[model samples]
Target chain A: MSDNLPASLPGQSDRVVQVDKLSKKYGDNVAVNDISFNLTKGEVFAFLGPNGAGKTTTVEILECLRNPTGGRARVLGYDVSKRSDQAQIRKRIGVLPQDFNAIDRLTVRENINYFGAMFKHQLDADKLIELVDLKDKRDEQFKKLSGGLKQRVGLAVSLVNDPDVVFLDEPTTGLDPRARRDVWGVIERLKSQGKTVFLTTHYMDEAEYLADIVSIIDHGQIIASGTPDQLIDTHGGKKTLIIRDAGEEGLKQLPQGLPKAELRNAGDIAIPLHNGELTNILMSLAQTPLHDKEIEVRRPTLDDVFLNLTGRRVSEEGN
Target chain B: MRSRIYTIISGHFKSWYRSKSSIFWTIAFPLLLIVLFGAIFGSGSTKFDLYLQNQDLSANTPTYFSQGYITVLNNTGAFNLHVVPAEQPDPLTYVKNDAQLHNRGQRLLVIPLGFNATVMSGKNATIQLYMDQSDQASASLAGIVHSVTVSYAAAIAKAPNHLILQQVGIVTKNIRYIDFFIPGVIGMTLLTTGVFGAVNTNGSYRELKIIKKLATTPLSKIEWILGMVGYQMILATISLVVILFFGYAIFGVTATIDIYTVGLVVAASLLFPGIGMVLANFVKEAESADAAANAITFPMMFLGGTFWPRETLPDIMKIIANFMPLTYVNDGLRYALIYAEPAQALTNTLIALGLASFFIVLGSVLMNWKEE
Candidate 1:
């Protein structure tokens, strides 16, 4: 496993996290298998996968909360598997575990300071609270905050130590859409401050929106790794043209020479668009009865990229 | 490390005071129990109740000397004397049942059958008194009986030494039920707060992923456990002071805060929470761990002599109480605070400290500081 190490060791380079063929097992079951990735400084690296796709196991190993069965993982230049190195790693890294809740009776500021005190040095709690835009709820107990505000407090706590790198495991997993957006705003702010963030999420849009580099993992292995646009362009099948509210009648009324169209779930007619064919397709549709129907071109997303590669779509709940 | 542990302790202390349920359990409920138990058993008639079973008979009539002895005891007016039939074979059992029924002290005074003959012939006669050693009224009652027996012997036989009064099972200490109960209450408060506090913090914090988050920080597991134990010590001290003060204010119960008392408090602070951490590790879920904690603490409270003396328990329960950690704590508290027996208190304190070490070490070993 040491042979797989890169020429430049951590701290010698800008690599904040380096995993060399990391594997974690539980007796007979393998949770994370021989997966490798690297996170550089000031980059938001997203490990995207479904619910049981070993995301948490991998993140915990990097956080020094778990040991790898076979291989090596280092965080902030310290080996996670070594006891001496784990202490160093723990001192430098910040972590927000999946479904983490702060001390219930503590106010938002108190909770932040409570966790902050675990470090030798901590960023100001008031500054963190302001960064998360939770100034009004600073004095409120954690249990009294809304889910969005509670998550904001969690973000503040994770940043309390002014860590070299932050690990956030499914930070917005169970929040409403608006809450998810609010959390995204906090992550954007973190990015603007040039802090390296290692995020694990099942939400493809979350990765597409926030990550500079995305690794899509499945069944304990990484299927693809690149920027969202690169993965989408390489694996995303085809962009389509959709006629809004146009029923099967729109498909039936299509011009004879046009590509075959199918009716979708919302009674819209969809026709695949190939490169350099958009102008010609529009000219063909201009003379048809369906030409008057509301029509627009749709681009492929990370969802399409995942579906095209895996032959299955991850549900909204990451099933 | 010191600052981290201090922060954890401060955080927990703040949470404890902020929650109404926590305040109610840690402070209000124990005080309430003390008030209720004190009110029920702390006050009563000032007169001692003594049961007399005169077996000395001549043709089923009381002999002259025995009748004279009974009259002398009555004239003292220190006892509300009740009569047991001379024909009763087992007077102790009868007194036990009768005394319990009437809410009186289970003490009996027996006169021998040959009292009249022995006294008239100028030979020695014996009067036997049976009483529980721990009874608060035993010393005074035995003293009265002794004085009456001496004067009666001098009046009837002209020899004060001719008649003997044998006091059985006597320990001369004027201790009331409240005094005994106050120490037990302190022990009880230490128990519930330590156990429930540890269980809820460890179990529910794991569920909330707070432990997981803390594991990623610079804090070590030892620091966290030390913080918890430190918090428990503060809480234990609070309970001791508040309950002792309340007991003094309400029932005039005075207690000495000796080194042994401090040792027992420290031991209990580690011991109960150690048991609780062990429970939480096994039970896993917060609610189930709570139920498990109840299963442990409720039986220990009742069988550990919290509300009554182990001597009053059935033989089997007394034997069981010997193995309970709280029994030693309660016993030690009573010795140091009320009884002032240094030797016994030291023995119990050592035993409690030993158990505390074993459980706390075992609990620390079993706790999952990191995800496995």
Candidate 2:
């Protein structure tokens, strides 16, 4: 840890963030129910949830942007509830709120420097530009940049202060697939530098790919918390054999006494695979006329884990 | 803290200068108004505004000689005559206030009682002409009045020496419409820039989550407000310098930049943005807040003596103008920049500063620096 950081309390030297039964309420509505979590030093923690799942509320609480109605939270060994500690938290943390945009008329470098000047010890704007790979567009005005380039600038701004932990709220929410991959690459660079990051996203693949530890939140409650593999192993159901483009005719042509098979969207036939049944499934399929069709075994991902846990699939729009 | 504030000021300034619309409104638009208004009204020779009070009345009507003299004066076509009521107990004071309100020269012509009797008996009759000796039009206007009185007396009674024109001096500023309008343009520019600047920065910045981003930094709400007010002061200074220079270069309108002028500028910088901040708080969306700003500033601009003198407005509009914040700014700028009336300037500046304090504090208090 840098010498600028305050001496951590006992048993919290490695913990960058600590939350105990944190709750936030707006009159009769509970935006964040009782939730406990911890973020250790140098770990990228992803808070996974759909839209309006209280992800922003909880992160804003840690950011000292909002007051929790109940319980306690600490960031960088400082209490977020205390007035003086909020200042310390502000100095040590960086935030990219949902739908952030820089000044429209300022160039990318100027915008970076503009936000950097807010901190006493800001990192070099050029370095952040290179890190976000926006050097070619450094002199371009923010309004003239593409959406992806603008998002990259936002990422650069969030790291300008050389913050202890950066909180990126839905940073890639509206980005295209390529742009999302680019932002993920930047986050990967931050991980390589061993900088702690707190990311919130409705995209399960984003959380599963970028995070060391993932917490799934629904209706203001933490439904599950573990590593991506652990959560998938615990909640994600059995793997399935997918026969591509096999319609109802393929299902009708299946061999007798086979496991139950179902026809899915796009004329694909799905058959659940139990343990040690790959060879038997393939052998039974070899005698069938549908054997010539393309076939593959797929492992369960976070999408299935969430569907299994909540009994509902979060759509692409996060509804 | 200072660096952060400076950064915010520079950032806003950069945005302002870079935007074409902002430059047009802040600099070009005001200059255009000055040129357009100056071209239209600056070169023309306006008629001397004269307030006429015919006190020589019988049965609520002017007597023959007095009525004939008034008609002769009207036929001269050198004066725009406004009739004061014959029963006005203190017509001089009334004219003084009304003249200042309308940007008119303080010149009142009073025909006294028994004028018809005195003239008919071939006795000496005096007509009172109340005007400021220092008025630029005083000498020419007095000569015309003297000529008209002698000619009317000769035509009416064939006694040219019977009518005497007595001049009573009153102090008033000799201000032209352009002189009055330049300060108003300055005030108008200040109003639009300060209010809309704040509205755009606060409303759209909030919408863009810029304020949210700033809140996560070490920068505080006070620093941000100070930065905004600082930028407003710079813009106000630029508008003042540009408009005053344009006024001087085009129409030869001169102004004095005294302490009160500075005070008014500072007050305007704080006052209008403060109002914008309050408006932004109530109306969250950027476009709606812009509409609200327009709704606020348009009435203040039209009613606050921007295009014309407020005294010419209807009684209710004048009352409403008194409550408008821009009134004091316009009046203060006129007093300080053109009229050179330090005392009136001081009064308006103090009032403007007081309002600046109230609104700025209210806005700062109401501003949502952090999310709840």
Candidate 3:
């Protein structure tokens, strides 16, 4: 993660995004309630949440599409609530909304070139199309393209202005495994180009794999923020073990002094304990009649950390 | 910044040109309508199939009265009259049923009892006119029938002994269905290009999370929208030109207004559809946007004189038509094309268009992309 972080960030001189006690309200409900966070250039920050968490609201306010109800948000040193600086901020930032949409009737090449022209320094339209690997279907209209191709084209369009900070809100929500990997590749490429990537994803794997800093948000507030490993460490120590067929008699005979234990299931269960207990648990299981049973152990993942902290899996929360 | 704006504008234009089937509807199809409808309907050879039911046959039937009506109908050449006398085996029932089933635009003229006597007695008689108003194809025939009948009665007044032929003016001569349709079709095509085509794409891109990919780029929403609009506008403009050129050439539609007025009209035209862009902000789904557009478009297509003259419509319907953008466009374009007016008063139209556009953008501003 340190290798991915720039030695000197683009907006390290000044904060690119400043959310000073920002709050967004929709009627009686608080969508983004008193949330505050800042983004510097060349940082890959992930906003993690379940579906319907105020992640979208927060992002949209920063995009200048919606106004913050309780506090102000400034993007690229321009106040978002003030309409005068909107165009300026908009010109500098690229936002890939949660949903993928482009003119379905337009051809791939047409879509790319049109979007390319929107930026301050236009990309080589043909080159951009080629970059997305949509050159083969350049003449084919948007409606004719497959979902992955459409998303690729959409990415090409977002890069049209060569923006400084890019916001990707749940970029890979509906994509299949391969298509999702393709999107990840696109992000990796953007990151290599020294662009700041702001991402929102419900997939813990995605947060763990892609994001440099992951911020877990719930009910319009940030619950936790840190590197994926740090987050997991803060929540609990590693080494989660799962064992099946710990029969009623065997369970009674089990060792009394493991550091941590969680009955994941009534019969088949998972226990998170220290590294020293493994040999003792295994030796005890061998001595008992419960031999040749399902037993597995692995390092604690981000998902385990999230569950440990929130008492719910990341997948169950708002994305 | 200026270059960025240009690039954004171009992006939209390119996207629109690439994605929208705008060329099909705006250019190719409208041109086809110009050629097809113009050739079929513009020749002034459109003859109405009329069934005349003669009910009364009495000795007291005035010789001048019956002859007078037939004379007027025959001379107008708008109708091919088929006289079905009451004495024939099947009476009103058969004719009424057949007429109803024949088609939507055919007219059945029923001459009731004491019809000739009523005319000779110098008393007003009410003739039941059954019109298939499903479309305006037979609108002129219905009007011609009414006029000739009135003239026959008038002829009787002027010359008590001899019937006189009075010329009825029906100036649907140079106008074809396509010519009549060009304005609304053009405007509708533009509306679809911008609203349905452009806005839907923008909304869905965000919805599908495609924009999420762009969220890493320097490109902004304004730039994206500008690029999109520019792309679509180019295609729209091309389509408009094709529709106009074909409509004029094939249908003999001579626009009345000068270039400046036409420019103003074209400039003002963008305002109404700007609302469509604004609506994109509020609409979250393609299905809803499509439904909303169709709901508004269908009525405007009919009531706004896309196929018929507002003057011929009922007073109430005409009044309702007044508020529609297509009504103003149709009227203004007709004045430019048909009447060949020297100059068009675009101030009011421009203002209306400006207001509509402002509201649309306003609506866009109010749209919550991430609704609570």
Q: Give the top-scoring candidate (TM-score).
A: 2
Candidate DockQ scores, in order? 0.82, 0.86, 0.30
Deviation in Å, model 1, residue B58 alpha carbon = 19
* Candidate number with the higher DockQ (1 or 3): 1
**Candidate achieving the largest DockQ:** 2
The candidates, ranked best first by TM-score, are 2, 1, 3
For residues B85-131, could you state the per-residue lDDT of candidate 2 as single tens digits?
A: 89888898668656644557889999999999998888899999999
Q: What is model 2's interface RMSD? A: 0.6
> Which 10 consecutive positions of candidate 3 chain B have the poorest summed lDDT?
B163-172
The list of candidate 2 runs beyond 4 A from truth reads A1-12, B43-51, B55-63, B77-107, B113-124, B132-141, B170-172
Candidate 3 versus the native: TM-score? 0.70
lDDT of 2 at A230: 95
lDDT of 1 by residue, A1-319 (tens): 1226563554776888888889999998989999988888999999999999999999999998888999888787778899998988887888889999999999999999999999999999999999999999999999999888888899999999998898999999999999999999999999999999999999999999999999999989988999999998899868899988888777777887767788988999888888888899998889988788899998888888889879999998998
Residue-wise C-alpha lDDT for candidate 2, range A121-158, written one tens digit per residue: 98999999999999899999999998888998999999
Q: For model 2, how big is the CA root-mean-square deviation? A: 3.3
lDDT (tens digit, per residue) of candidate 1 on B201-272: 999999999999999998888999999999999999998999899989987889999999999999999999
Q: What do the candidate models score in CA lDDT, each in turn?
A: 0.89, 0.91, 0.64
Quote the positional error of residue B112 for candidate 3 in Å.
23
| Clashing residue pairs for model 2 | none
Model 3 TM-score (B-chain only): 0.61
lDDT of 1: 0.89
User: Local error of candidate 1 at A143, Å?
Assistant: 1.3
Q: Tell me what fraction of the real C-alpha contacts between chains A and B each candidate also makes.
A: 0.93, 0.93, 0.51
